[model samples]
Target: MRASTPAYTMSRPMSESVAAIVNDDIISTYDLAQRMRLLIATTGIQPTQENLPEFQQQALLSLIDEHLELQELKRVEKDQKFPIILNDQEVRDEITDMASNNKMTADQLLASLKSQGIAEDTLFQQIRASRSWEHWISGRYGSRLRIGEDQIQATKARLVAAASKPQYDVSEVFIDAGRAGGMDAANKGAAQLVAQLQQGAPFAAVARQFSSSSTAAAGGDAGWISPGEMPPQVDTALEQLRPGQLSQPIPVKDGVYIIYLRDKRAGAGQTLVSLKQAAIALPADAPAADVEAARTKLIAVRSQIKDCATLEATVRNTPGVIAGDLGEAETSDLLPEFAEAAKTLQPGQLSQPIRTKVGLHVLAVCGKRAAGAAQIDHDQIENRLKGQQLSMISRRALRDLHSTATIEQR
Candidate 1:
């Protein structure tokens, strides 16, 4: 029973201007402006002339949703003769936590907002609506929700099987096209978000405030996703990104996405090893005497290379010897000599000096993880399933309210 986009008209307005009407209530121009400012301030999204219109649209949409949620909750409470109390203390507590995260006191935060010309009530009302809606959702639906043992087992099995694939630690921000009014708006919004992220905006904060994905509640953390698990476009994007980089806006059927890669690793079940190499570079056809000298030089320093940390310094101190970091890699992926050496040594152990076509090399095993070692526990899987269910329920309920409500935008 979802309705189409609520009819809207474009126009300029002063502080006292009416921006939208919802049921029997109104959202004023001042409210929309302050909310937009708050979004930028809390989320660290830079405000620019090019993106101001997108910001306004996002802010207005958020306000409309909040109005719908609050109004529905009030109606349910009154009709069912139940109490749905969200007091100032609760809002204050949230503010305190938020301020503490930003390394500011509540008073200081309010003062800072005041300096920005945002009224304190604007922040409070937003928090109140969010908390109230969460309470109502949990209370109304918590008991009815269930996760079967089979479901948990299936999820665990799937995760364990997928552990053999490469995984990326990722966070995302999704802009739903339907909510944004069309594909163009959604893409523009996603591009705007990407611009802000590239300019040093905090990704987690921005995701919490703006992403429409279910993971938005967890600041868009998707946590160790493997290839083939995500959409083809997303998989392609992740493949092109290195650790600590963001993807450009990727348009999909439902919306657009911006992803941040925190880290990536080889297949979890592979024999992962961290190594450092000390080598004396030599020609393939070097004289036997020259090769012997290189071997002697490496041998002399081999005992001195007690650990990975000191390997470089030891090499630097010894003339004609060079140091290299093999970094972390799967043993099978390493060169044959390096792989064989890695397989035989434990962490902190050094291999005997070995000769190769390029040089005489000494390898130190900094660390190792045995094959088939990845794990995701039962509790974590259960919680993820429950969260997904709750998110779906919340979305469906809200969509119903939107369809049944009276709304007009100006």
Candidate 2:
């Protein structure tokens, strides 16, 4: 037989100091504040007065989810003889790992956290909650998990392809313009979020608070993605970044997206290039006169262009024209349309006006280079696939738990 759940209660008229009530647990303003501190200490995102309210709001939602996780663990363990507890060494190691990420020693991290009035107990408790949730999942479903040879081989092939091409580990802050509001309201909200993000607010924290996507729960991490997987706008944005770059807010059909390029693969089978480009904006609905004007400008300059340096200087004299000195980049990273046209250009040769999502671009080849076959690692690929599978399984289990649980927020 199952233990009885606590009775539901009305939310008290909320104050700025009060966070939320989770079943019988009172997640107070103090808890929220401490959690925010923990978030910064672990993730290295500094807090600000401007982004504080939204950060707290996001923290509160996480607390609510944590509560759900805890509640489910408790219900499942009612028949257990002992409460769940994590090893102290594991907790310490986690803290050490987090400190290393922030370029601090474990003692320094502890001192810094203490200086900010945050306690080690807070992190310890969080670890325990997460571990308990993991335990619950393992007990319920771990027995069913198996990694077959076919899955490993498929993952290996994908990784080889990734190493051959370009891939990114990206984190996003997505605003669901479709349901949150119309595009006008969406863009405004997205712009506000982007501003806050630029002002030192952590991308993950903001995503958990504000994003409507499922990935928001994990701080809007979009994991490893190939080129075509992203929306057209996002894919375009990705092309313009290196690892650790933060992109401006991009409006797509459904929502506004802001991304941090956490990482990318760089190795063999890579074709790198440097190019100079002259471009004119041909808006999707541009008048014929404007199109012809840009066309005339591109053609007139085509013969005069010599090296990339000459084209860049000359494009300055032409009105409504912009030139690019795209320093060495992977050929795969180039805009798809530009990459094909660029492939045909010899050193010191110019391309005809190439149609891109942005506009018409005429390119000059500065230089190009390519690396040999990729150095692939089948073991790492297998591990990544396993991790991905486990993550999906964990999410599915949590969704099941949430669907059956009784939750109300203030």
Candidate 3:
């Protein structure tokens, strides 16, 4: 069956409060309002008339960009006539995933849409378009991209190093910053609770009884997180704590935090075997000699790296380098240049220097396993690869679409 028109258009005039036009499609003010509400709720931003206008304008521009992308995707689909398509079950599954990410059940999310004056069918239609676009893009571009065994090995090696580092399972108590008297009361209460914890009071019990965050119900558990994943102040406190220690009250931009280190575990799992590497870029207007000098330095750095460990250590020590353990890069996670370099290395080996738009890279091979190494599932790998590729392509496509779109605000 053909997908239905957006819900707002079905019962209302298409011309009413038209925000922008993308080809034949109209982005109405009603659509912008619903999107604004969703963005505000997700970002935890307090809504006000002052900010609402800005939000509405931004949302309308974003919608136009998305429409342009869908139009391009449709053009591709028509040209290729690819047999791959998202069935109704797949569409429903996508909706379920969206709901889960938002911490709501599918029914609850649908009800929330109703509260925002957005019909459930409208959202379903949007989901259909999104899924179809994904399908078309993957079918068109999947084969041209190559991710190899060496790339996965390098990623795995980095993950191993990361696992060797210390980690914490933390719990937090949050108090909303926007509420009147909220910050002061939460700060004082958290300070007292921290003192009580220092005096050996039960942390989880205190958290369950008093925290304002939804995680309070779960004893304020934030789950396992890396230092960079947390706010800087909170990260600093966690840095000083050993496992099973509790931190003093810390103020984040929007809340008060009292954290407890529940446990520590060594990273030795498939999940920890992922790594990401991006070639460092020189300034846009850099002198040719300076760019060449940087490239030569990167080559020298790559030449000394014998494995992922050395590569990671070198990047860590280098002033201008950023590297990460992506926990098992599939072919899709790698840039084309990196993937090509990865294809040449064995485990415990490093590749020759390769140039990309960013700069020069030396991809070091960390480890390799046959398709089912360490009990990693093939289907899981394929899905992860697909998701990563889709994200990269989508972001690029959206940027290009935005560049050409006409946008105005009232």
Candidate 4:
């Protein structure tokens, strides 16, 4: 799992070779090269001399996991006496969707990869393994899980309590040691992922493909989390991070985590307001008489506009007047003077003329959502709960497979 491994570890260097062995299956050197190309192509990681070894190691690791998963799928089918065959069309459909997401037709996508020296069959095989595993896992386990109202209420209560505390908007990439076959492998994989991230790879794309966390489906977006919501190591990492920063791999009991701090907020329960404004253009150095005239003109226009809907029309009729629709934002995001005026106004109420360097302006409060007015998303909560459970089960399943299987890394 370390970078000490040779970049080329071919048992037979004279011909097509094997990177590793998973039970009876051989992961070919050709397979490793194709997967590395795919990883770089999809994640946009800038390949370099220093990072190429890491990429090779990670690609071989991924290929081994896929081999184990495909073997398990077959074993389960044979034991259960059910038809668990992964339909060819399913894999093709997934490829088509991938192509569409990249703004290409299926044939065009294949041609593009071909031009880049990647085989079409390599892509199909990877998709087939992934689709097979996902279908089996979701169908077998997802249908059996049930969430109760008590659980939902408990989660909602926690959210409400956390609303009073500072929250972080974060994304993550988790490498499960169990799934990776050991702590060393997980750590190395996490480091490789970070290298790609640092080199401009898209975090979401990488997370969906590599992270074993429940949030992987959401591009690792762990939104608006307060203290004590994450693991102790993760919390410590977050505490030291400013917005738009990435954390180095943090080792934990089960795996390693990489955190990306997207943003931070004082709290979640801040008041949100929607506003509209009418302004009369005037220079700051204008004479006192001119300022008064602009203020006087704005006051007259404000009287004619009973609410936000009428403000724009009133501004249109008055020359030199401009209207603006300031969309919803937290009160803290607004200017201090504007925030004060907004706090005093109710929906549909107009503010007194306020003077700024740009002009004399009157603001209308379109709407306000009081602190804690945000609704709890029941569906989102349920999905999160289910995803967490599924992620745990998946790791255990893969771990068991790893323990029983014969694996050899060249």
Candidate 5:
């Protein structure tokens, strides 16, 4: 069946307001403002009056793509006859977690945002876009993503041969020099993204919002890269950077690049781990009693962890929790609870109750083993490669949207 005209129409004015008319939905001016405030709050970017306008310009770029992603997702869902929706409670939980991380309660967070004239739904939608895109990518690309045993063995063998040649942890934010308006537009976009990064908007967030590359799906993570994996110019920039330093916009033949150096590692391989875990999620919109009940159950389970020995069975006792093998992972692989848990736990240990926007998480560390320069996990490598491919697919999808849609900025 052909996709129906979207439930929304391009010509109709949104009651909330519109900054741009996407294919059938609107990017409200309010979205841009709230996102700017959220960026400032999350990234520790102070919105000095002088830099605020600069931030706004880049925020719009991010939102434009967000609209495109949602629109495409809608079409994909309809044509494929599957629901493409992000849970509202999950969205609330993300906001709640963000507030907690900043040492504020969700209500206090909302109040603070309102004081700054930011809309609550704007932040909610941003989180929704992020979560939904991740789901779409993983679901859409799970089957075709490739990493054969021979491929892994080859990569591992190559690493073994290299001996001490270091792998650099890298992330990127890209601007297409090949855009229709050409280098001038690309450079301008790159400059705006760089300024936002300097102002404290995260590189990943900025990249996801602005990058023309496929890595935007994973927030521009290029992952652990070998010496020859990148072009000479990008590699050269990598050599000069210490971890946490982001590069200036470097010119490539067809791309403008901003690279973030994450780290460099040797033996025990950045202290990575592989995990199998489960969680029982309480509704983010639930009453206090329900949330506390879930938390209490989580804490009880956490206390019972003698070791990773029986974590799988114990985690599944909760109604909504299901155990899944997460394969091999780095500390950077997960968000707060699991990531922190992976970092601190022994090989068989279980982490304490880590509250997330989604639910109370009890993580089990299935294995924590050293990864030498030559060692690689098949499942993990497959996931990483798949992520890269998904990003590319998403990029192509958005490009199609740009070519076909009408976007009018007011």
Candidate 6:
């Protein structure tokens, strides 16, 4: 006979006994409590017993969804005979990068997390889940993507255009009203900071001591950020100042900020590429043979296309095929294979089939423009596309899995 499944337990103090079960995975009351504590601490939101139940339910559901997705990922991989593994060193490196971005040492970050009641092991589990999901995606869908030369060339040209614009390097000392106690206190703090700067105190030294932002540890340095990256008040203030000049207290929503113009430069436009693609979707219950057949057909199409216009026309009448225009995307935005292909193509060239999450794609290089010619990076385009695709696949996968799952909510 098969051995019974293991039990799940938690160590935190909790008023409830159990929360919910995601398939065989149990979400405990203590697990919810720890998550609530971390949420409250990081966001500076007050937690109450009244709100705790709802928070616990929501958090439990989110964790359940994650577990379910992971199960589906594993199932898909097993059927495809794809290896899905998470490297511990990669997880550690990602954690290290997060800490560095926050201007905190790893030890300091761990201490902060502990103070917020977040367990290190919980974080590790989350990281493992994330890495596993990525590996599963690559294993299942990696061969479907083909980025082409025209796509890369278009991206490079866009980058060159973007480089022609103006940009500023700014530093700031932020005193949030909530942290300062009130608007009046925040204003006073900003004024005091201004006085220190005027009195010849080192800006970085004073920022290290008085700034309330995470950037405080980095001497309030924001580091070569574009105007669009900053709040309007800060951006406006910086715009009014010359290089090496400081601004008076600039009031903004939630805070008062003292701004310093570290340096300014003519924006260096980087290379960008744009591609038009046709994608075919596969149903959740589709057989492995059927999926492979579709992949082969798309690959065949890629080999025959000579340019973007021809590729676009070729997919015009195909059912379930989607045409996507990734306009002026950065090198970092396109996949590795796509970016490499983009570097060699002229305008109107067609790329080989590129595989992504949705299905097989045949790319067409629509146009190539120099960077800095325009703001090409649309806010969150890549993220939005990825999220939409993942959501679609996840919904289909979950539906299939749930049909056979024995789920209980408590």
What lDDT tens digits, residue by residue, belong to model 1 across residues 1-410?
21122132123344378899999889998789889988888888778899899889989999999999988877787899766747767777888988898899988998888777777787888887877887788888877888897887677556545667778999998888878889998988888889888999999999988888889877899988777666789999998999999999999888898999999987765677889999988878989999888888888899777778888998999988899998988889988878899877766789888778888899998866545554556677788888878877887887798889999999
* Candidate 4 lDDT by residue in tens digits, 60-119: 877988999989988888899876655556666788988898799988987787777777
Please name the candidate that would achieve the greatest TM-score relative to the true structure: 1
For residue 216, give model 1's deviation from the true position in Å: 1.8
Q: Candidate 6 lDDT, tens digit per residue, 1-410?
A: 11122132234563666667877888777766665555444434334454454345435644665577667766765787654545555666667865787799766776788766677655555555655665565455544544444454444444444455566777878876754558886787577557657767677755654565546646778665555556888877777889989899999898899888888876655556667776677665667786777777777666666666576676665656666667778666678767766755655666666655545566676655445544444223343334335534544554576668767778
TM-score of each candidate structure, all chains considered together: 0.71, 0.54, 0.46, 0.67, 0.59, 0.41
lDDT of each: 0.82, 0.69, 0.60, 0.80, 0.69, 0.62
Of models 2 and 6, which has the larger TM-score? 2
Scanning candidate 4 in windows of ten residues, the lowest lDDT window is 1-10
**Tens-digit lDDT string for candidate 3 (259-307):** 8888766444322113334246765676889777877777666665555
Ranking, TM-score, top scorer first: 1, 4, 5, 2, 3, 6
Lowest-lDDT window of 10 residues in candidate 3?
Answer: 269-278
- True-vs-predicted CA distance for residue 164, candidate 6, Å: 18
**Residue by residue across 83-170, what tens digits does model 2's lDDT show?**
5434566666777875687699988877777787777666665766666666666655655667786776555444444444667789
Top lDDT prediction, candidate number: 1
Each prediction's RMSD to truth: 14.4, 18.1, 17.6, 13.3, 18.3, 18.2
lDDT winner between 1 and 2, please give it: 1
Query: Model 1: number of clashes?
Result: 0
Better of 4 and 5 by lDDT: 4
What TM-score, to 2 decimals, does candidate 2 have? 0.54
The whole-model C-alpha lDDT of candidate 2 against the native structure comes to 0.69
| Whole-structure CA lDDT of model 3 | 0.60
